[model samples]
Target chain A: MSDAKTAIDVNALLQAIPYARFLGITVDQRGNEITTVLHFSQRLIGNPVLPALHGGAIGAFLETTAVAQLAFEFAGAGNGKVVLPKPIGLTIDYLRSGKPVDTYGRAEITKQGRRVATVRAEAWQEDRSRPIAAAHGHFLLQVAEDAAAS
Target chain B: MSDVDFSPEDLMTMKDVLIEHVPHAKAIGLKVEDVKLSEAWLSVAYSEQLIGNPETGVIHGGVITSLLDNACGIAVQLTLPGRMSIATLDLRIDYMKPATPKLDLMAHTHCYKVTKNIAFVRGTAYHTDEKDPIATCVGTFMLAANRAQPLPTTSKAATEAMKILAQKKGGDA
Candidate 1:
């Protein structure tokens, strides 16, 4: 769906989501992979002693990235504007404590069906190979026309 | 870590320090409703700032995850014999439904199992009815060996206020 008529600006779509803006998540296209970044902010820290980034923030970043990925990839399939997928479930594994630093995330769409999608996301700070956390999530995909008809 | 002596009062004080020092907790306006031996309850008041979807007005799932994480950590702390730090190792959350907008959400967590270095926790988030929860989580936390520094003692007036509040709540500490 890379045709000119079907192109969609994923960043603009992300910005429309209030929580994505609240978390200060930004998206960039590196070739075909979509990278999501969460800039360091004191307001995102959960453990003051370790000064670690809140796990929830990292999880949210990954989840949002996955949703953005689905929206970007399947932009033209749905009628009208892209319908953002709703999270069905999320499982995050904290591989290490997230240091208080800028974090990056990317999601792999393992499966994309008509009504559901499964995504696996990883987040890292400083080193991409050594992710601080990884998450697997399933989201319910909605077709805009179906949504409007319902 | 060797078990150290601590009173129920000390744990309560630690909870206050935790909620105050954690920047995100403060940003989300989380409050400790109660803490017992191996359990804790936390609440976050409804605020527009926390809304994830402007169209729905429901608070973000991230906020609920943070609340459950904090509550689980607090439960682990309460189970520990002394003040010691803990970090989340893994957390799995199943969103049962969207939380009702404009209602204070509460999370109740319990540390059901503990070993030398690991604690298992389960938590539920709800608004009015506990039976009908908005989300549920199961997580594991790692207990660090180093003892945590005690929270600074409160001022006399603050202590008196805490005591009065405790009494009013029919608590014996």
Candidate 2:
């Protein structure tokens, strides 16, 4: 982790992904960790009877947060530019039902190399200790050549 | 567990009800295409709202995940004896390739196994050619003990149709 934090417009970066906008995902960066938030909405409900948040929605939120965290780290690395990381594979485990409420998520970069990166993410509504779901995935990092050309 | 003798028409009505009740599925424009004893096919039309990368005009991976998840759940429902609530326990998906822009996506899912409380599923999503899939998924769902209420029928005829189809299946078997 870099001790020096770079000035990056996290909102603008998230806005680039249109689906993030649809889900109303927001970011909160304090120290070294970046927290993602998804406010409750009727459109995000999957089981109307339980009024539980859609499993897909939770998966999407975690994936998006992981991608955003990587982009943020890349921007801080030097060039201050963000590139979209392509997801290769994702595995999510649902620990509990996501009650309809404002959900929070955080992603940790387990490994980062020149071409690939691995991220682990978790989401929770009320208590961080009790996560509703957790996801870990591998992504193809944007190489310097592609970043420079773009 | 009692076996459910469901005809083709009865399965179709059940699919319609399931899709209609799942708000997220309805919002994503997911439609059940076909349903059999332990398998199902679902389709999602291309929409601008689902675009993840505006530059390439490709739909988001999340949309594909949602479709696959829902498809697997539907397959699990078909495999069970009667109406029961089910929740996804875990899902793993591998993106083989980016989806074709402006093209609809389809998922074919099968419930491979069912235990007392768990149902396992496998599925594939494709754009046009079934041979070339965009993604593949395997998942597990936990079945609730209580019987779930049937989704509201779109028409009285649909309910009647299901009864007739059930009768036909019972007679044939």
Candidate 3:
């Protein structure tokens, strides 16, 4: 509910995705920001000795965050239907070992072009100042049908 | 190719043990089909629970990321002569196109070179032919991230076997 205009159901959009359900990711929409949560599970562990969350899981969560941001932005632009933004490329840097706890992600659109968007995302566990991983990526967005026709 | 002469059974066990050590690989049902000297091939089948967009039923990009990462790690493991811990330093992936729904994804990775402290890897994910790729990636892993923890049981045995093979190549056998 950050925008003063039309409301978008973030949770419902995530729930429709099968992988999102498997990862147990949920959205926390607040005044001016939206946060995506990744609940920890033993299945997410990649290193049993270190007991660290899988790098892939963290990367995937960050991707979801960027896509969610795009979807919300599209809905706010007066577009009725949401089209899943397709990722063009992604680079993820693992800053720290992801502990066995809940992780949160947020994405900021760095630039949006006519056909592509660039986003930077971060994921953290306990402190926002210290992120466990960071990512920057590009995604292809579909213009609205009316805009396309025009 | 390695100096070590592995029986078919050793290779099979090596592949199985490699996947078993990574819990997420098991969770996502990853299989290590081939592990050459410094190359690896792995696969994961399509499943409904892995679709990123329910409307399109396309598998999420993260699945491909995980598959490529795992393949790279296995490629690095096969390059070493002894037990050494490695952690991913960074990974970059380029998505060529959305994967065809219900088609199993396969990944092949090669660790072409390893410096004293860094290992470099490149990988590709495809459905059938490696020529037709769904995604491609390049990554680096830090070698000897830690030595305090004990190496996995099967890896220990495999390294020991490799050491003996190395000694034989040195004309000591």
Candidate 4:
């Protein structure tokens, strides 16, 4: 449980979405900066022959990372309830492919507005110096009253 | 409409032709998995070479876009029946989560409708955990008659694939 200003339970949110749980995304720790890990595996198949991971998979990873950043911020708001933010647009730059191992992602809150929030997210394998992909997105925040009444 | 024939191997070769034609796709290792009247599936695996940050171990987003774009094209080919080439008008993807390390993704893409030149498609990517879709994509493709003659081998292969699919369905039924 969180205060009125803080967001809802992070673990609760993660469990709510089956896909998020499958990706191994958890709250980790809640604050301005947040970290989430996606345990990479070879089971994710694209072309059975090449068996290389698909690009769309990377994009989803980036998008989810970005959303999680927003959620972390929301939780930090101390509202005691996590809010679901919708992405209006996202632009990703794919720099490289992921290796056969777990990859980590981090996010920075560039700007937070009344209606929209801007976030920048990056993913890396073992090291932080270089990232496999980088993404920037605009998220529209939804308040509980607006969200629940719907 | 002239009847064109293609075998599975011929279809595989034509896939190479399509990839070679797209310069960006060629650089990224985009490949076609299956092609039919209104459905298709495409895949690419995780690779260290494809990461933007080698130190951090992450894959690029553009690669995913390329896969989705190719899937949309294949979906359009399914509607044309005859020889057809397709172009993407617009594509939007909803990334649900980040990909796992080393795991490849298969985009199970299919065309839902084709009206005139507009072809609509929807697809999702899954690894071992089908419940967690790595990405979801929706796109519109512009269908145009192909100038090149349909490879005889591709036509034949498509027929066979369809037959197999039908048999499997029949057995299940």
Candidate 5:
């Protein structure tokens, strides 16, 4: 409910996750809608000839963002242990070619169920109308009870 | 902030960059199908190299993600011109079913829109059995403004080595 109290230091949280550290993703802002930034670098290339960005790299960024979003929400709740949500399913819509640059993405929590959490995210660069891509994800939540009981 | 400066060929070819650089993409033999200014499609032929759990002869989730990531980049390049460097802001993938070994993976992508500094795109990945997708992904990429040209990394070689090691470990196990 309150994103502020549970607000995670984006840099600290991302650094904690090795993969996030690899992508160089940083939390741009913290709240109900968690905003993050992925700095484009040489590490994310998919093709050499045309120099397009890689899809897996993008996917990793998206998946990481989803986890961070849930973490933010859990922190807001202030009563549960920080749990890592594993992505059970996801649907990606590739709208355009992602150039080699610093791309910004924003994610929103659509529904946070007891066991499953649904999230929607849109990415943009210089233009908003033309989004680089959009993603919806299903994350399996790890709750304090589930952990303690285990 | 204004407009990207790349040709259709550049846009399509950019997707190739993903295949060439990313370690997993190389392991799966990802290849481009076609590239237009505003639209692109690509595919990968199933091979022994793509297998994860060899007993089941299923493709690995890493391979599927590679295919979808390349497709999403192509979708963005289709609309933007002239080498606009983009990074994945976020990406979500759904593994509808397990991909069989030796099957062809086709990925189709389109750019939704391109604005001042942001771009939107979408795509789907399927196999010979076009009705079903081994996995589907949606991603959001943002335009990196004031970003310099990309520097080439020999990172793939290290990744390739790791894959080989993994294969050997799998075999031993």
Candidate 6:
């Protein structure tokens, strides 16, 4: 019943999603914190001249972090899988160019209402203090059935 | 932005060159279907690799974000007189519905206005109908290098475009 007792597999939850796999995303959970990592790959380059990571790629990775965090929070530990949350909208502010390096993302639940949850996520390349981008997202959470299948 | 005496034909030829440099666009199979001064249309066909929720077979919302972002960026580039370093300063995407599996996603973007340091763009992603969009986005891009501050003429261009779009929808309906 408690989050501490529930063994959540955020990586497994990510692996089941094809786009997450395509993006080469993995999770690092330390206690209650889950930080999603986007592995550096050549295919992620948007500006070949500057060799910066694609903006869309960074946006997607950050969004994935938020969704995984939401699932980790709501999915009961020992549950086989977590039903994925759907994003209603996202506002991404690119503070700095995404360097072509391994990027890290983390999401914090800013607000949790009845049918919706708001999350704030940020991505950093080298220094956590200096984030390359940040996002505020709204998600539609299906709590009526929780993990009930269609 | 001042006028760039470019014909739609001139910009149309640069569509491939516009997307060839971005590896992510190629990785996701994004193509520039059409391009004009301050306007662009791009599309990405659905594939298993792009699916978000495998159970329902819907394309990931990220794909839509990428498509819309690129479309907005390309529209800004098409507006400029020459190629310049344009960075997406910010982008906001509003999802209207999940993308239908196996249906190609297309986005049309317009850079309606440009100021000294920024270019404003609005875009919509849809299967075949723009009115029934899967997602809509508005973004601002920071322009670098050769640029100028000019009167707002593109808004008129945008209004003309709206009339054309309205007529097309009416005909389709």
- Model 6, position B64: C-alpha lDDT score: 89
How far is A38's C-alpha from truth in model 5 (Å)?
A: 1.1
Over B25-89, each residue of candidate 1 has an lDDT whose tens digit, in order, gives 77778899988778898999998877776676878887888889888888888788766667789
Question: How do the residues B70-129 of candidate 6 rate in per-residue lDDT, one tens digit apiece?
Answer: 889889888887667788999999999888989999999999998878999999999999
Instruction: Give candidate 6's error at residue A77 in angstroms.
Output: 8.9
Question: TM-scores across all candidates?
Answer: 0.86, 0.87, 0.88, 0.51, 0.52, 0.87
Supply DockQ values for each candidate: 0.31, 0.33, 0.39, 0.06, 0.13, 0.34
Which whole-number lDDT from 0 to 100 does residue B34 have in model 2? 87
| C-alpha lDDT score of every prediction, in listed order | 0.79, 0.82, 0.83, 0.59, 0.63, 0.83
> Judged by DockQ cut-offs, is candidate 1 incorrect, acceptable, medium or high?
acceptable
Higher-ranked by lDDT: 1 or 3: 3
The residue ranges of model 5 lying beyond 4 angstroms of the native Cα positions read A1-4, A30-33, A76-80, B1-64, B67-92, B95-173
Top-down lDDT ranking: 3, 6, 2, 1, 5, 4
- Which should have the higher DockQ, number 3 or number 6? 3
Q: Compute the interface RMSD for each candidate structure.
A: 7.9, 8.3, 8.7, 12.9, 9.8, 11.3
State candidate 2's TM-score.
0.87
Better of 3 and 6 by TM-score: 3
Worst lDDT 10-window in candidate 3 chain A? A141-150
Strongest candidate by DockQ:
3
**What is the TM-score of each candidate's chain B when compared with the real chain B?**
0.80, 0.82, 0.82, 0.68, 0.70, 0.79
Q: How well does chain A score by TM in each candidate?
A: 0.92, 0.91, 0.91, 0.81, 0.87, 0.91
lDDT (Cα, tens digit) per residue for candidate 2, span B7-46: 8677877777757666678778889988888889999999
RMSD of 6: 10.8
lDDT (Cα, 0-100) at A71 in candidate 3: 86
* Model 3, residue pairs in steric clash: none
Model 3, global lDDT? 0.83
Tens digit of per-residue lDDT, candidate 3, span B1-173: 33644556756755866576666787888899888788899999999988997877899998998899888988887887665777888999999988999999999999988889989999999999999999999999988886534235476653454354335335231
